[model samples]
Structures are given as structure tokens and as C-alpha cells.
Target: MVFLAPKKNLFNLYFLRYKFIFLTIGLLFVYILLNGDIRSNINVRKCFSDINVQNKIEDILLSERKPRKGKTIFFHETSCNIPDTLNHVRLKARQACAIESAALTNPNLDIYVLFASPKILNNQTITPILESILSYPNVYLRNVNLWSYAADTPIYEWFKDGKLFKSKYIYSHVSDFLRYLTLWHWGGTYLDLDVVMMKTIENIPPNFAGAESIYHVAAGVLNFDWDGFGHEIADMCLRNFQTHFDGYDWGKNGPGVITRTLHEICKTKQIYLMTRSRCFNFNVFQNETFYAVPYTHWKYFFDSDYLERTLEMTKNSIAIHVWNRYSSDTPIIVGSNVAYGVIAEKFCPKVYKSSGKYF
Candidate 1:
């Protein structure tokens, strides 16, 4: 007797036919979810300079015309070995204060603090210190990873082809590179975790960077729009980074990258660097207004003299980078005489009160 084939429902028929294909897809989905985007692998090496993050900001400078209204950004690169441990609590809190201060002073601006890893955001309960920062109405948080910071831009593939940070160099260099890429992707201010806003940044230009000295432009406080100098400068800087890199010199990738790129850009512009008032596609802020505290004396921010000399500097300064490199282990005591303690109480009173530690 011949047996007849059973009629099957459409769903069952399709499922039987595509079972192997569906299994393969399901496995891939699980792999991606468990491992994250392949583009994010740190070793997926790319030269810092040559990677194309996005457009050259200079070409779009004035042509870009205007920036999206109200934008400021901060990057917290915890992945580069910077953990939120007790030893680092005050410094992290101070960084949070800087962001909150900016948000409070400039209510019109949309301030963002991008955490490089989900470690902090993933925590079920963030430390009380972080509470002060999260309380701000204007401050917002984003979870960015290695891939998100530089991926899907003009140079995502190029970067993935080459190695990024070196094992020998301090991981902060990784942060330095990410800041440049993030700024290139989205033109806006990029603040180091060390900064503290003293006043409203109402004067920040559409495409602008601040100078730490006549020869060096500090990347600590930088801003730009996608179509303007921000992109142009970052693109050129990344290229220079590929050609001239010194892992031993920490600044080589940070301030040095921008300073070296400025020379190349200025040469093309054929404008004299005299008077230090040189104009580019966007704008350049001078040292007097930007670098109120020179690198040599960054430690003063933790001393008592800050009440006098430091405040004097802020007269023309937009913010201060307390140089936490020298003070990461330092604590900000309540009702203490330290400069950082004073600044903390003034800018992040809530955090200071939450500390509940007399020491």
C-alpha cells in the first residue's frame, strides 16, 4: 500500500524547511549579544591618525553655518582601566561635579556624560557620590563602548584594521584617542574627567578649541560641529597621529596630536601664526581665556592658595582642570581647607553632604 504525504500548515512547513538556516541565525544572534559587536574588539587595531572618523571640520567651518542648539559632552572612559574604586571616589566625584556645575550654570545647554563601559550604569545602585551628578536636571548619561565611540563613522573599518592603544602606554592615552574620535563623530565639547566648571560656558563658539599655551592647544576642552572645524581638525589630527606617535610621551596622543595637526592645517591655510590670534575655518581661543592653570601648577588646586590665586584665574577662565593625575588619591574633606574641598562644596554640595565622612 502506498502512503500519502500529510498536508502541513504553512508555518510548520516553512519551519521544517528552514530549520538549519534558522539555527545558524539564532547562534549568530547569541554570539553577537554575548560577545558584543566585533568592531569593538580593542585589538582590532587601527592607527590613531589615519582613521577617518568623519568629515574634515575645517572644510565645513563657516559653510556649516550653525550648530545644533545646546550641546556639551563629557566622556568617562572606564574601560581604559579606570575603575570606580574607593581610592578613586573623590576624583570621580569631582569630575561629576564639573559636569553638574556646567549643567547648572548653563541651563540652556544639553549636557551629556557618556560612560565608556556599562560597569557604572550596570551597577544596581550607584554610589552616593554619583547621585549628586545624576540629580542634575540637565545632565544625561549614555552607554558607549569601544565600538560605539569610533565605530560606523568614516574610519570604522580603517580603525578596525589597525591596533589602537599600546600595552606600554598608560590607558589614559586610549581615552585621549577616543575623545578625538567621539568629537569627530559628533561636534561638541569634550571634557576630561578632571575638569570643574566655574562659570557658565555661554561664550563657547560653534567650532572652537582652547589653547593651553602658545604652542599647545589643549584637547581637554574642545568643541565643534559636524560640518565645521571640529571635524576638519580631528580628521587631520588622527592622520598626524598615525604618522607621528610616541607612546612614551603621554601628551603625544592628547595635546600633541592637536598641536601637531594645527601646524599642518595652518600651513595649508598659509596664515601667519603671529599674534597668536590666527583664524581658521572655525575659531581658536587664546591661552589667557582658556588655560587659567598651567600644567606645572595643577597641584595648587588641592592647596589652600586656591582661594586667592585660583579664583583670580577664573576671572577670565571658563573652567579649571584640577589635573587629577596628581590628586587621584587625594580626598576632599568636608569643611576642609583644601581648594578641591572648597570647589566641591560650592559646585557639588549634594555630593559633599552625601559623603558623610569627616575625614
Candidate 2:
């Protein structure tokens, strides 16, 4: 009787163990089937991983630049860890370079380049470009160290506490914040590196606030009034940055946030948003019929075939933006050729007679 009882107990225990193993296996299989290959991808995992301020800035600084060779332009990607499935960084770099080249054409202008990099030591290749740009009277390079304050915080704590944020959010927030700050301290224009200046922007009226279109406040180019409203706008942007801790989609949200805030403040203060005849590009509400130019006007600015066609259509545009379709192999040679020809023939006749340098 005792032997029979022991065998029965062992059999029941073995059966229960097998059942539990099978149940666990079934649940795991179901999870994998439902989630696809998501668990296997490390990039997705890293996006949600805890990151410290120093580490975050380090990643942003280390992101690959296109051409692997050449002057590093005035723009740096925010380290948002958004999947680079489509090579978005390459596109941004190309667009930035195009803007830099275009901005360099004006002799009287000063180009200010802003970026956040982990490494404090200046890059060798970028040094020459900075030196070259600085040769002109007004160009300046400013590196804003974003991680200086929270360097000692742990990665996990920083992420959870909102001390660490994605790069895009930081960049957009900082840009808007700095724009207002600069105006409050010393007034000047805040030009998005994406914009190309077709005329002397120095002539922008002191009281004027520039916008691309009325419906869309083209943040790419802003000439602030720098008195009452400008100060308020800067303060609001800074406050939002400290509070939101996310939502930094530059293409969509950055300008939208600024415009909405500015509009609200303007209403309360009884300050009307001004619409200039030809000074700004984004104003859509002007009574006088104005021309709306495509961003491709800047992209194809240097392509001989495209330039010829564009010149025939509108010979005098102050600026054009190349929004997308930017790449390292962007036809700079072709574009520069057209630019030189146009500058010599129309805008600045002395371009050829001066330094006569070609990149």
C-alpha cells in the first residue's frame, strides 16, 4: 500500500510540472506572434532605454555626417534616436550645406552657426570652414553645451525625471528660446539655416516682424521687433520648454507652438501682426497680389538647366528654400555654376572681379 501511494504522488507531481512548462511555452509563442520581430530589434529598445544628459549629447555629436569628407556645415542633428530607416540625417546635412553656400554669397551678412556637441574640442575639418566664414566681417560659431547642468545624474533617473530629453525637442526648444533671448539682449534676425537669402536682409525694418506667409509664420527667417512682444514670446517659449519635456517635432510642432503663443499674446496686448509687401515670404494674407515660390527654387538654383528655366519665369526672387530631396551628391557644382552666372549678370556684378573663388 505504501509503495503504491509513493508512485501515485510522483506521477501527479511530474504531470503538473509538464503542464506548467507547456503553458509557459504557449504564452511565449503567442507573444512573439502578436508583436512580430519587435523584441529582436535593438534600436527600438534603445529608444526607450534610460539616458543621462552627457550620454545623450555625446550621441548627438557622434552622429555620422555625409560625404565623410568636406567642410562640416553649420547644422547638427538632434539625437532623437528616431529610426534612420530612410537616411534622414543625410537629407538634413545636404539641405544645411545648400543654405550655408547660399548665405555665404552676401558680403555684408554675418552667419551665426549654432550646434550642441559632446566633444568640446573643435573638429579639424570644420575648423577651416569656420575660419573661412569668419574671414567675412560678421560670421560667428556658437556651441551650446546642453548637458552642462545635469552631467552627474544617473541615466535611468534622468529619463524618468525628465532631465534627459530627445534631441529634436531640445534643439527646437533651444532655438526658439535663444531667438527670443537674443532679441531681448541684442536685437538681430534669426535665420533658419535652411533659408537662402536672395537679397540684402540687413534692410529689414526695425519694427517689422518677418514671416514667410501670413498663415504660416515662417520661423526659418524672423526679424524680431525686440521690444515688448519679442520679450514676452521668448519668456513663453522658455517656459514651455521647461514644462512640456517632449513634443519637439521641428517640421510641424516647433513653428506651430511659437505662432500660437505669439498670436495669443498679440491679441491680449493689441499688437497686430504686420504684413509687409515684399520683405517676408510666408505672409499669405496680403491684399496686394504677391508671388509664391516653391522650395525647389533653391534646390535647383545651381542646376544650369533648371536655372535657365527659373530665370525665365522670375528673374528676381529674394530667397528660396529647398525643403526635401537633399543628398550628399546634391548637384553643388552645377548649382554653383548657375549661381556665379546669375550673381555676375544680375545681383552682384562684382562677384567675379572680387576673390573669384569657387568651392
Candidate 3:
């Protein structure tokens, strides 16, 4: 017993010799925990020789929240309903400009362009426009099938040509479904092929959708994360997509779903101010900063008289939706003094170069 007591005393004495060092380390850890500056003071030493203090400190710092590194990314995708006629849907220079504008404006984002069609892949043709988009390091093009996006859901087979009622807008409906699936599962920004980015997308919190008009939240620009209310909204929309789906109605799948979901989330049918964005879970923007020119005024993009006015309006907007459906048939004159020409020249010089004077 006497020998054991002496040995214990000897061990205590050994530890007491570095008591000041141990106390200093404890204080340092407390300071690090309190102060959010995790990037500083990485050379601190620990009293114990076996401890890898730096790695332990890193783990602790990362445990607070998901460590988000690098510039924020916006996810985008497009679907060609008639995959058999992929050549008709090959990426055009204007569409390429939409992607280029996104990458050029943000510079940090990795824009993902998912092509949702099986038949398109069978006979692949890379147009000059697609070649230009492929050159960007940050832009990625991928294949995403309908079953791949909504395979497990109830409305999985609804995408089949013969399964649903025939309509001219079936392709558009499928696009809406794909956007929901993409944002729900992947969780990032979704831009229409017609939209062009004008400014950096920053400061906005996650899980947000925007309204182009009163009670009309368009799915063209949807930004969300995989966590929190994003997944919930997606789940709600997908489930309802199974229940209240209509192939005959044009807006039923796109804007209609958004309006219905908004009502479900807010628990009201009253005309709420979209500008205020007082939803319970996430926010919805109606302010023109999100979409300067509404889809109805899409022709203004190609009109020479509205060129000066459009340019003035675009300064405040983060992006402009060109409403390709309305303006797709119109030719873009590179130097004939139009808003589209001016926008193309400034935002995407490469695309403009291809268009030249008469395209």
C-alpha cells in the first residue's frame, strides 16, 4: 500500500509540472468555441502528445452547421418532350447565352443543365450553340429521364405519351414535373432555358419561390435546399401531383400547382401581397427585381421601340425571363437596335457573335 501511494504521488507530480500549459489549452478552446473566427490560430499545441488538436478543432467547427465552401451554385434543367426530335431541341445560341449569362454573372456557381429525355440520347447531335455551352468549365450538361426523376412517385407513368390525355401542352406539363423533382431531390436554383441572369444571386436565404403576378408563383425560378421546408414543399407538391393531375389543362401543372401549394402552405385563399412574402416556412418574391419584364410583355425584348426602356428596366433586375414561348419565333437582329440584341451583345458576346447582323 505504501509503495502504491508513492507511485500515485509521483504521477500527480509529473502532471502538475505542466498544469499551466493544460490550463492555457482549456482557455484557448473556450475562446475558439465562443468566437466564430474558426480560420485563425491553427498552430496551438496541446498538452497531450497523442492528441491531433487541429483535426479535432476542425471537426468541432464543422459540427455547428454544414460547412458551405466556395461560391453558391444554381441548378438548372430543360426537358425536350419529343426526344425523338432532339435535333429540333438542340441547344441554340440564345439558350447557350442563357447558360453563359448565368456562369458569367455569378462566376462561382456550377450550373447543371439536365436534359430529361431518353430518345434524345439515342441520336445525339451537338450544335454550335451546345458546343459553346460545353466550353464553360462551370456549366455541366447531363441526361435525366422522366422515370429517373419521378420513378417512385404515383404519377410516374403519367409522363408516358399514351397514359395521359392528349394535349399540345403535355410537354410543358412534364417540364413542370421535372422542375419539381429536380429542386425537391437536388435542391438548388432552377432557371428556365429562356431566362438570362443579369446580376449576382446572393444574400437570399434558402427555400424560396417567386411569384410573377398576384397569387401566381411561377416555377421558372425556384431556389431551395434539400433540408428544412424545401423537402416538405416538394413532397406536398409531388403527392398532389399524383392526386390532382390534369394533362388537358395548360397551366394546371405549372403555375396552378404553385398557386395551390402556396395556398396549402399559407392556409389562405385571400389575396396576400407577394412583395411582402410572409409565408410560414419559406419566402416568395413578387417584386420586379426577380423578373423585370413579365411573360406577357415578352415581345418587348424583340421590339426596337422598347429597347431603350427595356435596358433601363433591366438594371434593377437580377435576371430577365425572355418568355421564349412568346418570342421563340422572332428573329434576333444583332445590330438592328433591339433590346434582345443589346442584351445578347453585352451578356453573351459569343452568342451575339454567332448571330451577327441578320440572325
Task: In model 3, state the lDDT of residue 253.
Answer: 79
Residues 114-152, model 2: lDDT tens digits: 443322223333443333334454444443344432233
**Candidate 2 — which pairs collide?**
198-318, 212-281, 212-282, 212-283, 213-282, 213-283, 214-282, 214-283, 214-284, 302-335
Worst 10 residues of 3 by lDDT: 41-50
Go through the candidates in order and give each one's C-alpha lDDT.
0.61, 0.41, 0.63
lDDT of 3 by residue, 303-324 (tens): 9999888888777777788887
lDDT of 1 by residue, 1-359 (tens): 99766666766878887997999999999998757534334432321221222221111122333223326565554443223221211225566677777777777766766544333332445677677777787666654455545666655664565445442453666777667776776666777777777677766556666778766778887766765556777677666765565657777878887677766666532212522345465555676555677878876766775667776766677677777667777665678776667766777677667766631
RMSD of 1: 15.5
Lowest summed lDDT across 10 adjacent residues in model 2 is found at 65-74
Candidate 3 at residue 268, lDDT? 66
Candidate 1 — which residues are off by over 4 angstroms?
A: 1-70, 80-91, 120-124, 268-277
Which segments of model 3 are wrong by more than 4 Å? 1-89, 119-126, 153-167, 270-277, 356-359
State how far residue 135 of model 2 sits from its true place (Å).
1.8
- Measured by lDDT, the strongest candidate is 3
- Superposition TM-score, candidate 2 onto the true structure: 0.52
